[model samples]
Target chain A: MGKRSARLENEMIEYLPRMRRFARSLSRDAADADDLVQLTVERALTRLDQWQDGTRLDSWMYRIMKNAWIDETRRRQRQGRHLAPPEAGESVGAEDPDFDKRIRAMSVERAMATLPDDQRIAVGLVLVEGLSYKEASNVLDVPMGTLTSRLARGRKALEAQLNPDSVEAGHDD
Target chain B: MMIDDETLIAFLDGELDEAEMERIAVAIDADPALTDRLERLQLSDQAVRETYQPIAEEAVPDHLIAAVRQADRDTAPDSETVLPFQRPTGDRPSRPAWQAYGAIAASLVIGVLIGSRFGLTEPAPLHFEGDRLLAGGVLATALDRQAAGAVGEGDTHVQLSFATDAGGYCRAFQQGGTAGLACREDGRWVVELTAPVPAGSNGPIRTASTALPTILLEAVDARIAGETLDAEAEAAAIENGWSGDPD
Candidate 1:
């Protein structure tokens, strides 16, 4: 580890909670989620010179987590580590009913797994995390329209998972 | 009243300005379908956020806190910009940037240094055995007996002999109106390159015989570890079988 300012380091620590939340929202596995966080922190620390002091640290952190997740996902795909697919998320919860937190985490992971990487991240950043569309798009490095479209698609997918009946009822509007 | 989903989303997320929000609000008020669509998007988001609440509220796993606090083990900040291609100073002996291209043909006869001083005459057909030049024929005879300053048979002259930074010996010479650089490898001379010999060439890289082509001069500059072998050193190299002894 090279020497970074204590201020930057402390600020990064302050933001770890939401960073982990965003990481979990992107990655399906807890271990992988934490791994993404670890990778992002390491990257951000190593590249602290790139960060401006007054800018939103959360925004910068989110972008790093996003890029790190993409790299991690590609590596995992290359390594054939695609973790038994989304179907496993549903069944694993049923089999391990005693762990409530595990069940809740798995259920969220299950809902998240319904969307592709792009849409899921859009939803995670905008709808769930309450980033303004502009900020979310900035984090995503996408235009506002692209971010909204992905978020809409991601919401529709999660809506289906949440209220299967509403989707079946054909909320055509 | 038929707003696209992205526009509707921007409206629902309050990303629109007051005017656009007002317009969408009026449109939604008049259209139950729009209202329902907005409701669904909002409800889905609410439900997802609720599901995620526990994760955010859950105690940051001790492991994660430890990871965040473990700054000493984390990157210091410049490592991320370190170029991916500039690998650490490593043993990069992988067929280097030093590309020497030429061929030793079995029958493509070379206009050898017809050296009378070395008792050599006429051209020789030098061939490659496994890409290593077999110092055969008149050229080999000139090189083996008197590789130093042996301008024996014609205007051809062995201008200089020097050991390379790569621990190999190279000889620069002009023959048959062509200049060439040959470096010793595996006990045999490999004609690294040969170009049409230039006349009166004084390149910035060196001030040797102007007749020495710039290619040969540059080749010597690129390879010579220290200095070209003096006459005594060249004689000693001949005595040592030119065994890459770095004389």
Candidate 2:
């Protein structure tokens, strides 16, 4: 491997943890998210020339993951698979059957999983991944205004889901 | 200037330009309602952030790591790269990834942070000294010894090591499903706060250094002064006994 490729690979390794977090938020499934992350890694490694040297590698990788996820979601739909309802997302931590009794503090993540994919990705990229609005917009291929609106909607949805009694119409312009 | 939810949220996310940020900061200081709105938004933002953050600490699946390592070797016919494989059940991934490294870290990992047993289990890596709770056992050893991202023989992995503006260092650490931040002071690792890391935040994930619980993150944000150390800086800090530069 060339020295540049090796350095980039190391950077890619550092970013895997965060990329997985973004994938889970987008896919709303752990196993599915890992698939998305792996796909992104493979794509990014081969397309190293396409990634601009001065640009943020993480952002480039995120865009790849987002595109891969869209492709996967479409493929799943074509196979007659549909998204499950929000109630089904309670199994987000599905690996642990005892999740209810074990992790009471997970209401936040549960609420997040209930969001629509666009809103969830907006929230994940900006809030969870700590991407700036401009960076997140580029990653999602949306305008900054679009990103903010989705984020506001995602935040409101999460508020209602997490604290239904305290819901308010505070998100409207 | 009218501050809509988008503008306020933009300010909250640090996306506003300096002038806009200053304007919002002043308005927040002057208007209780604005401050309340911002705080409420911040609460939800922090919660959402903390929820997904634990995923970063979970061991990156081996296949994913393998993909990255083998990126330069793409000339080889690695058909498995294109195929999805069942998660290795033999790894018993439910436990935090600490066990994958060695027995010492596995042994010193958290017992139980859930329910009423929080912070009360035996082999707890922390205890109180006077009014200050300090790192007692392996957590202390890890904080004292491990550089950032180096999961050594210590029970804890120091995921991040950064200096505060006050010339002291703080580290974000994880011991199994337990994660917290401790800053160096008085030659001791003072525990600012510790919280139960959601065991299933991501793929029933655990181990490695973690993103702190919201409260600990708030504390770190308030104190870190925007000086998170890079690897070289972290190594130098460790060589200097986890203290920030004298200057």
Find the candidate with the highest lDDT and give its number: 2
lDDT string for model 2 (B1-247, tens) is 4578888888887888999999999988998877867777887776677667668878887678667755444432332232211123454344444322233234454322322233444344666689887776567767877765555433356656666888788888765555678888877888886665544423433334232344555566667755467768877777777654332
lDDT score of residue A39 within candidate 2: 88
**Which model scores highest in DockQ?**
2
lDDT of 1 by residue, A49-141 (tens): 787767888898899888888787788799988843655543222344467645555655677875788998898898667899889998888
Alpha carbon lDDT at A77, candidate 2: 83
TM-score of every model? 0.52, 0.53
DockQ of each: 0.16, 0.26
- Model 1, position A9, has a per-residue lDDT of 46
- Point out where model 2 deviates above 4 Å: A1-4, A84-106, A167-173, B29-32, B76-247
TM-score of 2: 0.53
